[model samples]
Target: MTQALVDGTVIRGHGVASGHASDSPYPAGTIAMQQPYFAALGLDLTGLYLATINLDIQPAQWRLLQADYTFRALRWTDLHPPEDFSFIHCQLLWQAQRYAGYIYYPHPATKIQHFQSPRMLELVLPWIATISYGARARLIYRAEQIQIEPAALL
Candidate 1:
C-alpha cells in the first residue's frame, strides 16, 4: 500500500499513475479509477463531467463526457491511430460548485466510466493490449426501471 497527499488530503493506494481492474477489457490504473472513486467518495455526477488528456508531444485537449459517448472521448488522440497510447500519468481538477471534473494529461490507455450503484461499479477491467486499443469496450449497465401509474380521466 502507498500513500500520498492531494489538496491536504491523504489518499492510500498503490502509487502514482496506477490502474485498477473494472471489467474484462479494462485494466486498473489511475486513469480508470479517479472519477468513479470520486463518485464513491460522494461526488455527484448528475451534472457536466469532463476529462482532459495531454500527450508528451502536444498541448492538452478536453471533452464533455455524456451517457452515450464513445470510447474515443477518453483516448489520447495525438498519440493514437498507429501507435497505442498508454497513460503514463495525470492530474485531476474538479469544480464541485459547477458539478464538473477535469482530468489533465491522463496516461494513454486510461479509461473512465459512470454507474448508478457502488455494487455494480466494482467490476474489473481487462487489459487493452490483449483486446486492442481501438476496440470499443462496452459497459454492461443496468437499465433504469420505469414505473407506471394510473392516469386521471375526465
Candidate 2:
C-alpha cells in the first residue's frame, strides 16, 4: 500500500489555520515560535516560504517515512492548535525543481476534525505560492538535505 514518493501528487490544503489568521498566507505564530529554534541551529527561515504545501501521500507511504523521520511537537501554549504542530526537516523535488524545507506533522486535534485524509504531508517553505493543488511532487532524502522544486504550480 506504500506509494512511491516519485508518484506522489500535491494537493491544495486550504492552507494552515495559522496562515489564515494572519494577513498573509504564511503562519505567523508557528513561524515566530520556530524562528529561535532555527536560529539556534544556524538555520535561516527568512529565505524560505512561511506557509505549508499539503501533500497527499498514501497511508502506507506516510508510515514508511514516519519510521525514518523524527517527530517533534512545538507546544508554546495550551491553546489547541488549528493545524499540525510537529515537523521534521527534509528535501523535496517536483517537476525537476528542488527545495529545502520541513515536513509538518499536523496536530492530531486539527487532523481528526479538519483533514479529509490521514496521509497528509505539510511542506513549510518560503515560497509556497509557487505550487498549486494537483501538482506532482517528490520527497527525497539525500545528504541529509530536503529540497522541493516548482514551489508554485502557476
Candidate 3:
C-alpha cells in the first residue's frame, strides 16, 4: 500500500522479513509503524515484522545474523539501527542494534544523496544512553539510474 514519503523516498524494507523472536519481552517487531514525521505525505503503514525461521545449525545462524544486521535497522525512529547488543535487563525496554550497510554516491545525472558513516540511532529515553545506532549509508546496489514512476506524480 502507498503511504507517506520521508524526504522523498519511503523506507521500503518494512514487512519484508517474518522471523521474529517468539519469546522476547518486548514484542518482536513492535515498532514497525511508528513513523512520527512532520511531512506533507500521509502514510497508512501496515504492521510489519520479521519472519519466523528455525536456527538449527551454526552457519545458518551466522547468515541470519548478517541479514538481520542490515534488514532489521530499517525499522526504527532514527537514521541508523543497532546491529549488535548485550542485554542487561529485559524490563527497561533498553536494547541496542549495531549499524552496517551500503550507501550510494551522488552522480551528475541522478543527483542522489550521499550516505555518510557514523549515522544516528535515536533512543526512547532523552539522555544517559551510551549506545550508538544508525544506518551505515551505502551506495545503492547495482548503481542503476532511478526513474520516477507515474504513480508518484499524484
Candidate 4:
C-alpha cells in the first residue's frame, strides 16, 4: 500500500472536543469521557491528548470507505445515544517534526451533535506545545483506507 501526503491548514473547531467550549453542554469534553470506554475496548490512548486538532484539507474532502478501527454504537456518553466511530493511522508533518496519530471520524449517520464538515479531517495527536490555529501541516495516509478526492465545484 502506498502512503500519500497532503498539505492542510490547522483550523479552529467546535470546542466540544477539548471541553473548552464555553456554552458547550459537555463541559468535561467528549474525548475525556470517551477515553475510558475506548481504552477498555483495547485502544489505550495513554499519551495522546484528549482533544482533536481540526485540519482543513480543502479542495479535497475525505471519504471513510475503510477504517483501521471502528466501534459501533459506542455508549460513551449518556447525553445522546451511542454513536459509531472510526479511526485510521495518520502521520503528520509540521515544522520539521513528524507525528504519529489517527484520523478521528465520528460517523455522521449516527452522530447527533457536533457535526463536522467534510473538508475538515479531525486528528488525535499527542500534546504539541507549538501547534496553534492557522498553522500549516501535512498528513500521510493510505488512499485505500481514507479516500481523498477533489471537492465538488459549487
Candidate 5:
C-alpha cells in the first residue's frame, strides 16, 4: 500500500465513542464494546485504546470509499439498529512520532445515531500521552483506502 499524509486537528467529539459517559451503558467504552464483533468478523483489535481520537481534516472532506476491512450489518448494540464500519490502515503522527492506528469509519448511512461530520474521522490506536483537543496532528494512511478531497468545502 502506498503511504500518504494529511494534516488535521484533534477536535473534541461526541465523547460517546469511548462509551465513557456517565449514562453510557458500556463501561469499557464503545470501542471495547464493539471489539468482539469485529473480532468475530476477522478483524482483531486487541490492545488498542478503548476510545477513539477524533480528527477533523479541515479545508477538506474525506470519504472511506474503500478500506482494508469492512464489516456490514453489525448489531453490536441493542439500543440502536445495526451499523456498518470500515477500517483503513493508518498511523497517527504526533510530536514527530508515529503510532500504529486505523481510520475508524462507522458508516453514517447505517448508523441510527451519533452521525459524524464528513470532515471528521474516528481513529483507533494504542495509548498515547499528553494529547488534547485542538492539537494539530498528521495522518499517514494508505493512499487507496481513503480519498481526501483537499479542495472540498466543509
Candidate 6:
C-alpha cells in the first residue's frame, strides 16, 4: 500500500571522506542546531536514520528538479554559517513514510568531500537496514515531481 515518489537504484558513492561526519566535533552541535527546526516542523528524530542513501539519478531528471524544486538554506555554524558550508532542508519519503532531513553538498570548507557528483542527497531515517547496495528504492520528495532510474552498472 506504499506509494512511490521516484524509484532509483542504490549505488556506491564516492568515498572521499568516509564516515567522517559522525566522528567530527560538529555532529553534536549540528544535531543540536537542527533539533529546533525538526521540532518546529513536527519531525521525530527517534525514527531518523543517521546514514545516507546515495541514489543514482539521470541528468534530465536532475535538470527537471533544478527547474522546479525550491531549496531552503540551513546554516549550522555558530552565529551564522560561512557561505562555503551549508545544508538544505527537504523531505524524503520511503515505503510511504516521510522523513524530514537535508541534502548535504560539500563546500570547500566542509569536512566531507565529494567529487563524483555536484550534489548528493542525504536522508536521515530509521530503516536504513531495509535497503542495500544495488537495491532499488523509491525516493519520494514532497516538493516537485521527479523520476530516477536505477544506475547502470559499470
List where candidate 2 sits over 4 angstroms from the true fold: 1-4, 21-29, 32-44, 64-73, 81-86, 106-116, 142-154
* Rank by TM-score (best first): 4, 5, 2, 6, 1, 3
Best by lDDT: 4
List, in order, the clash count of every candidate structure. Answer: 22, 21, 22, 0, 2, 4
lDDT of 5: 0.85
Give the Cα-based TM-score of candidate 2 against the true structure. Answer: 0.58
lDDT comparison, 4 vs 6, better candidate: 4
Model 1 agreement with the true structure over 77-116: per-residue lDDT tens digits: 2332321121111122222211112223222344332211
Model 6 bad stretches (over 4 Å): 1-4, 15-46, 59-102, 105-112, 116-120, 144-154
lDDT by residue for model 5 over 36-95, one digit each (tens)?
Answer: 999999988886886899999977888775788999889998888898899998999999
What does candidate 3's lDDT look like per residue over 11-116, in tens digits?
2122212214454333434233233220112322223112211111111111011111112222233433432211010011223332222121111222112221
Off by over 4 Å in 4: none
Q: Which one is best on TM-score?
A: 4
| RMSD of candidates 1 onward, in order | 18.6, 7.9, 18.9, 1.5, 1.7, 6.9
Worst 10 residues of 4 by lDDT: 145-154
lDDT pick, better of 1 and 6:
6
Better of 2 and 4 by lDDT: 4
lDDT of 4 by residue, 59-119 (tens): 8898887888889999987778999988898888988988888898999999988889889
How does candidate 3 score on lDDT?
0.21
TM-scores, all models, native as reference: 0.18, 0.58, 0.18, 0.95, 0.92, 0.47
